[model samples]
Target chain A: MAGAPNQASLVERLVFRGTRIAALVILVVLVAPMIVIVPLSLTSGTLLIYPLPGLSGRWYEEFFTERLWVQATWNSVLIAVPTTVLATTLGTFAALGLNRLRSRLVPAVAVFLITPLIVPVIIYAVSAFYFYSRLGIVGTYPGLIFGHTALAIPFVVVTVNATLKNFDANLLRAALVLGATPRQAFARVTLPLILPGVLSGGLFAFITSFDELILTLFVASPEQRTLPRQLWSGVQETINPTIAAAAVVLMLVSVLVMLLAEWLRRQGRRIQGKQ
Target chain B: MERADRRRELVGWLLVAPSLLFMAFFFAVPIGAFLLRSVDNTDLVGAMPRTMAEIGGWNGQDLPDESLFMALGEDFTALPDITAAASLGRRLNHNLTGYRSLVMRTFTGLRRHEGPLGREALIAIDKRWSDPAHWRVIQQERSWLTPLYLLASLDLERGPEGIRTIPPERRLFVDLLVRTAWISIAVTLLCLVLGFPLAYVMASSGPRLSSWMLVLVLLPFWTSLLVRTTAWIVLLQRNGLVNQVLERLGLIDAPLTLIYNRLGVYIAMTHVLLPFLVLPLYSVMKGVGGDLTRAAAGLGAPPSTVFRRVYLPQVMPGIIAGCSLVFVLALGYYITPALVGGPRDQMIAHFIAYFTSTSVNWGMAASLAGILLLMVVVLYAALARLVGLDRLKAR
Candidate 1:
């Protein structure tokens, strides 16, 4: 490393500088559009034009007061909360089972479980529409919950599985040998360690259900329109600044979810590192 | 000891059963059923059960015997209602045009006839039925399954001679399939161009800087696709921020047509999918130390050569994984293209949705979806072979 600065050629320096600058410029382009929405959402004007007529919170107020927005928010929460609970419980157990699995079919099982995430959402959405119809749950809250839980389960499985990679099976054995039952062993020894994973999985499931559109489009009735579904139709209209406010609101939820997930990931890593 | 090991294994299987069963019931069976609709032809065969059974014995050129004509009359006359006949005709219409009207008209014609039902009488009812071409479609579709939808999805059809391409005017799905792949490849390349340098910088940076850059990438990465699409509209619409800035800079006298066009689709999709490529590439690059590049430089290899020869191969798996992820995701894109793309720019997924919701044609939708699934599975198998699919886990 000693001769690095001295030995570097002009082409080398120029290329590095160019890449760094290009990277920064692209990051701006990647991130600038979302930041642009905060102002547009705050615009008092009717259109999404620059040189705002003036700064105002009317859009936010409209977003809060409007029935469509309010109803969609409620629907999103109702679906996502149940989806989170169901997906997290089912997926954590699936991961725990997978972690202990010694069968040659483990790879196939994992692949099958993760298929919901890998396959196109449109495929799943269309099929779910048909499947739900067969069950007569096409437009119901329970249908969306079940539909969303399928999509969300894979994320939970992946997260918990990752956390479980660092988990030691002997801990369960030790707890059992100390006169604890299997339930006690799992509760005291394994649960606390995988809490971050479970929470992050739930968070992922929530956001996944919350942000989903295509599936909701197929399975949801007009009465069951969720936040993303509402934004979907609103964006198509392009006549309302209220959509911008809604977009910003959704973006905030996304950012908060991401931060929490990141923190949980780090926490999982920290706990694993200590072990 | 053996019993205990078996018990533990059983416990593992039991724990996995609930999720496995749920996905099977919800996800796998439904998609499998939907895709199978491309070949499903029970309704058509069931509607003309007598005709289907009798037609199997007839030669292609000649009119069927008295039993065949009698069975045909019975099948058409036995119709419980017009809707069943119409629905059967609709199914057959997919195989040969004009079958719907033929079946509906003939159903009424048979209903009115009181005397003997023969081949001549049936032909008198619907003159078009005398032609063997119509009979050929029924003959081919007598089976429980037919390739009508699958053939049509590729813009081909079974004709008098055999399978042949449809007329040029009607050939659409082949182009749409090509367009889907073309757009996906273009987006993947666009992502690679933009993501490479960013990942490079992120990997080479200090811990704090790297994490910050990672957040910069992940925030948009994790944002709802619709939100990102909405953001793009807010920024790229005419008189929007982009055009406003350009106008202020005197770059153009009028606002460019940005949103609702091809350029807009590229920009927004590239933005949405760029992180898929970057995250994996960045993680791969982070694992890839700079020692080799430095060693190459120490040996007098130029930066370009060092990069191409030394560094690129090290991150090849990442490039493959990331690019495939972007390409695969891009192929199934519906909302982005629907929201941003002009009518001329719509992809295969658009038609899949059109057939499902708008046209109410499950056969067409299933066939289109089948084509899409094939494309995805082929790419998936490739990626799974080249770089283990497990390595491309969602972050």
Candidate 2:
């Protein structure tokens, strides 16, 4: 019996070793493409045929010098910023309201909030084009902004709702009993508690609108084209190193935003752990 | 106090009112209109009133009347300039190809018409118009509510006589739908297979390992989709690092067909969508306790039996949530697949885009879109039934 038990332990240890190595290998495989692209973007060659010819920043220079690329970057920022603000505000408020609602309605409200996610984007995008064209707002900024907000709102609802799940209702009662006004209680207690979730939701909203492609293509005119739209047309009509430079910039921005979101989530976890 | 509660409820509704209105107008109404367009007969008769009237009393057995020819001549002569003709041509081209240039030429030739419209005048303008078949098409489409485009969208079309399925050789859209579903399902499965273990590890690991793993997983989320897809192209191309490594390692004799194919599509899409799966799965798994598996093991059960009977049941909800989330997302995927996947691998979204952009067939595009929406709803409903979403989220 001792020998048998010892043999089983040895087998378990070997399995654990194999699984860990496999996990590491999988991580390397997944991360390699992203790592490779960063270096290739710095290549001097016009065509992106691997084993990069030489090192240069000409593509990055071209990206800055080019009029359309600059305009598209500016356009993406314009759309992403306002979209983030709008989606985050609406989504946070909705999440708070839903959290306060009788628990029975939570599932129903959740289903409603998730429609934009469930429906295929192509359908929504095409319909939006027709809908906007009929209203005569197809090529306008507000039109694209609202369109992006609709897409981003779902992310806000999901993220904020997740954060609110852990919230204690008694905290609100405690604050009220302490003679704090309703508004004051929420500002001092509720806001501080859910602030990380709100910020994470906001970051997701910004990245969503920033990275959005399909709907932007439908609604954005040449003058209002977003970064993804410009990159799309660039790929279709012509391939240039400038696109690689733009890709590099987009990669950096996305990574930075996600990193910030991860940091906030960690802080929230730590706070919860301490409690 | 009741009044105050009511007021607060009203404010809550007011806050969400704008978004709801936006979705109703831009999302719901347009889908309704798109479906309506499939059955819309206004344009067929609206464009050619005289021919419509001339063909009203005609039967399907015989050729159309001379009056119909005269109406065609009149309609062609009064047709708008090349731009309008091109737009009309684009609409008709959705039903049948080669009609765009024909319509444009006919419109251009009509600018030089000399006499009152007749058969001779029609023949003089375009010899192709003399065919009875061409006359029959004009007569058939004279109805205000012809179902040509809708039928063609479903691989069926109405001839002068009645509706017929498009020839097998000409069929593409149905195949496109199947391909879309296949790719979406494959991507969903791939995400689950790749993400399940990682999410499990994240849930089960120590803080240091989990945080490091989280950063690695989230790194791709920081980049734009177009950039990530382009990166895959660079890495998977024939002479790219992947192939080069394979070649040097004696894994193959020749550069393998990697990028610009279904394999590339799978690799790139799986990479992009893995995060969606992991985030949801990890969050759900974080709530599941590990003691159950150990408890089962200590009860005189084998490890495999313990995992099957105790562990898998608990993780089912996470798996379902992750699968549905990834599957629905994969269905709408456009940029990644379009850039990496070859022509045959194009999904339904690609055709929706093609019809919207290149073909300009709003009706057909909407019908295809309607089908996609219906598929998602059905799948979602089925998923909800299989594993209740609340149960999934709770786990």
- Candidate 1 backbone collisions, by pair: none
Q: What C-alpha lDDT do the candidate models reach, one value each? A: 0.89, 0.79
Residues B1-395 of candidate 2: C-alpha lDDT, one tens digit per residue:
98877777776666556656656666667768766776676765676677778776766445556777788778766666666667766656655676777677778877877777776776677786666655566666766676666677778887655777788999987787778889989999888877877787788789899888888887875677787887777778777788888888999999998867899999999998888888878887888787998887777676668768988888777788888878887887888888888988888888888988886777778778777778788888888787765556667
- Compare the candidates by lDDT and give the number of the best one: 1
Instruction: Give the DockQ-based CAPRI class for model 2.
Output: acceptable
Give the per-residue lDDT of model 1 (tens digit) for B175-275.
Answer: 88888888889999999999999999999999999989988999998899999998888788887888989988999999999978888889889999999
Which residue window of length 10 is worst by lDDT in model 2 chain B?
B56-65
Tens-digit lDDT track for model 2 on A182-214?
999999988988889999999999999998888
lDDT of 2 at A139: 91
Q: What is the TM-score of chain B alone in each candidate?
A: 0.95, 0.85
Candidate 1: stretches off by over 4 Å: A1-8, B388-395
